[model samples]
Target chain A: MFFRLTFSSIRHYAFRFSLAVLGLAISVASLVYFLSFGEGARRLIRRSVEDFNLQLLVLPPAQSLTVQPLLPRSLADSIRSLGVGKVYSILRLPYTAGFPPRAMGVVFGRDFSSSLRFISRYEVVRGRDLRDSTVREAVVGEALAKALGWDVGDTLTVGTGRYIVVGVVKAGSPMVDNAVIVPLNLLMEDMGTDRLLAVAVAPPPGKTEEVLSLLKREFPGYTIQTSEELVKLAKSFVALGDAIRFGLSSIALFVTAVLLFAIMAITVQERRWEFAVLRALGATRWFIFRLILAQALTVSFVGWLFGASLGWGLAEVTSRVMVEKFGLDLVEVSPSILILALLVSLGVGLVGSLFPALSAVRMDVREGLGR
Target chain B: MSRLVAESLRKTYGRKAKTVAVDGFSYTFEPGRSYAIVGPSGSGKTTLLYLLSGIEVPDSGKVLYGDTDLTAMGEDARSRFRARYFSFVFQQFHLIPYLNAYENVSVGLYLKTGKTDHGRAVSLLRSLGIEDPNRKPYEYSGGEQQRIAIARALITEPRVIFADEPTGNLDSKNSEMIFRILTGLASEGRTVIIATHDLALAEMCDVVLRLRDGKLVGS
Candidate 1:
């Protein structure tokens, strides 16, 4: 009978109850959508870090606020002479490298043998790998090829010279998938400099820290970092993104609670006479209180179910947009998110109905009837 | 059934300018008899009913039911006592708007016990000539709604029934039917107390008490 009365009352004020439900749904959906962006960024960074194969990176220390110091050829030789591990020097230069001179894209000049030895799974999907006989041959990553519409044997312009695309590689990382790769000597001749940006060193297994300390000791003016340290540095950049997501979710929940409180307050005010009738007919104050709470819970439960489904759908659309516009692989919607959303909605329901329930319990039966 | 006794019951309303609705009024009502509290407007008839039924506490008085001091009990205990010993029918036919006639009758029973007797509820509504138990209060006519309210009051089978103008909103035919129902309860050895201005209905009771300006003038 209690349940019947609660449901009947809700049905009596269906429009008012529906507005509360809609408010909760929108709040939950906004929370899910905001958190999804954080999840996407974390996944993208983690994938990139995994693809790098835990190699130690060595870079020239910054010389000025706006200028990054470059590694000369002599420094590269000195690092190679240490024989602590296999070293691969890479020179990254920004250039317009498409058929119609598109905006800046990275051109990587690397030692072919050492790069292949350190970076595993650098497979050539089409044509052949870079060889000694082909001086101006280049290998474009999957994303770069797709963006420029280039296939094997197509000529890609880099600065003043054009290199024939001899291979299309799939590196399984967004950073590598959007780059153009060429030989170190060819790139040095084209750029008129022998300075490199960084050196990737794959130390013998279990000798990572040993090589790291040795490199820092020998090259005092350079920065040395292990792959784990690089990953930690990247994660630091995403902390602000996480804080923004938290702020957005908090604001959404606040708005939802306020909306629910307003609607429920008005509902209780409108039904004071009805509640007083129940009280006059042998209903205890506790019964009236619980009935109001039950009504709020019913609305919140239905709203949460609908909100979770809407949030999932919206998350999928957001993931697709991120992948298309930013080349990020972030399309995962975890069950924990849905569970959290439901819990938040339930909490909102409880908090929002507290004052209204109290008012119902404290109503004056005579005054209410008189009204 | 239990006899009701009130001793010098005093009640007042408002803080700034006090109005004594019931002042030093006392009466004793016997069981198994019908009594009418007849008075003009502002004669404290409804306030006297509320005090006797344990719905409101008096300012300085004692109301007893067969030697049990109802005025000394706590509000929660009084509510339980009221549920077990008394039933009420108001002038406004205060039926829950959301509930159907059948559900409205079952509310009192459900509150006392955690269960409802649907069969008894349906039989009571049928006996009251309410054919459709599924119709809400607003869907019914004034007389039907009054009948539904009476059914709800009778569902608990209390020792005493207090009604404040139970037929005020009904037509002449419905008023006679309601008066007959109250008289029939008295014949069945249950106490019935009604407050109304209708002298025709008042004359049908076994005893009549008249009040003016919150004080009893005739009996």
Candidate 2:
């Protein structure tokens, strides 16, 4: 009976409630769309970090993660002499904007003989794995291969050098999925430089910090960090981005709440006499109050339903577009984000309806009857 | 079966430039009888009905329904009492516009018992000449809408029914029909109090009390 009364009231005032629902839905959709990007970036960073499995990266001074091929090739042997862990030279060159082959592609030159973890992370889904670091052969990531329409035995051009596509690799991280892996020596030879961008080091168990301290002291002109430190840095950057996006979404949510509140207040005022009739017919103040609240909740819940679906659809479509156009997975619609949106929308309903329900509860039967 | 007593009831409206709506009015309404309070506009007939039903508290005086002192109880307790024992009909029919005939009548049962008796509601609407209980109030004529209101009143099976100008908005034919329904409730051994401007309709009840300037003049 309570549900009948509440829902019937909403149905009768469909247009008015629809305005509220639309307002709320737009707010929730914006929230989901914005937050999904943050969630996607965070996951990408975590997965990329986890996939590398390297304890330390040695980059040139003042360089963060960007590839700057200034470190000498002999730095690998110098780091290997420290007895902290095995070291291998790695080189990476990022494509500039408007590169026909791919704009966001990275040419990764890895020491295939020693970087076994890196090789294993990018599983060989087709063709074969890279062997013999001196061979002029390349393994393309699955997404890059799909983007470029490359298969095994295909020739690929990168930075004025051509190599055979020996294998296609797949990984959970987009970083690996959009990469072109070639032998370190061949890439160095192609670039006409004996310099290296970075060195990958595998430390002994429980000796990460000791190895890091030694490398920082020995290679003062380079930026050396463990994989965990890099992951933390990436997470902090993502967290800051998420906070700003959430803040932007909150403004929309506030507008939705205010719109709902105004509508409810006006609705309660117009139906004051009807509420009086209910009271005279034996409805308690609490009953009237709950009826109003239930009506608001119904509106908000319906809005949430539509908004969540629209937002998820938008995220999926945008993700597809991002991957197709830029080779980036830029949106993620996780279950946690859906749950959070639901909880926040319900809270908006409760807050928006509180005053209207109170006013209904406070209405006098005689005055409401207009007697 | 209980008697309703209103002792020296006085009700004043407005904070400033006050007008006494009901002044020292006293009456004993007996069960199994229909009583009509007949007066011109502003003579306090509706105020007296409100005071009697505990819909409005009297400025001074005690309204007792048998052993229960309605004037002494708090607002919520009085509301519960009204739910359990009293039902009302209004001048405008006051049927919820959104609800169909059956839902309107069933709501009374819902309010009283937190449950609905669909069978009882259908039967009551049928008996009241609302053959199609699925129609909204706007679809019904003024007379049929009043019948729906009366059905809502009867669904709770209250001991007392208060009708304030119950036939004010109806034609002679509808007014006559509404009076018949109220009188029938009296015959069923329930107290029925009505406030109206029609003396002809008032005469149909067992007792007609005249009010002038918020005071009872004659019966």
List the DockQ of the predictions in order.
0.52, 0.76
Please give, for residues A158-218, the per-residue lDDT of candidate 2 as tens digits. 6668899999999867788888999888887788889987888888888888988898899
lDDT for each residue of candidate 1 in A1-371, tens digit (9 for 90 to 100):
99998899899999988988898888888777666666666776777766655578887784311123277867767888999788887677764544565423468775764643443556788998778624898988776687667899999877557899999988777666766888877787777787877777888889988998999899888788777777787677666876787588778788888888998899999889888767766677888889999999888888888787788899998776654544445655577667777888898998999999999888877777772
Candidate 2: lDDT of A202? 82
Estimate the overall C-alpha local distance difference test score of candidate 2. Answer: 0.88
Worst 10 residues of 1 chain A by lDDT: A62-71
After TM-score superposition, what is the CA distance of residue A67 in candidate 1 from its true location, in Å? 12
* Number of clashes found in candidate 2: 0
N/CA/C clash count, model 1: 0
- Candidates' C-alpha lDDT: 0.81, 0.88
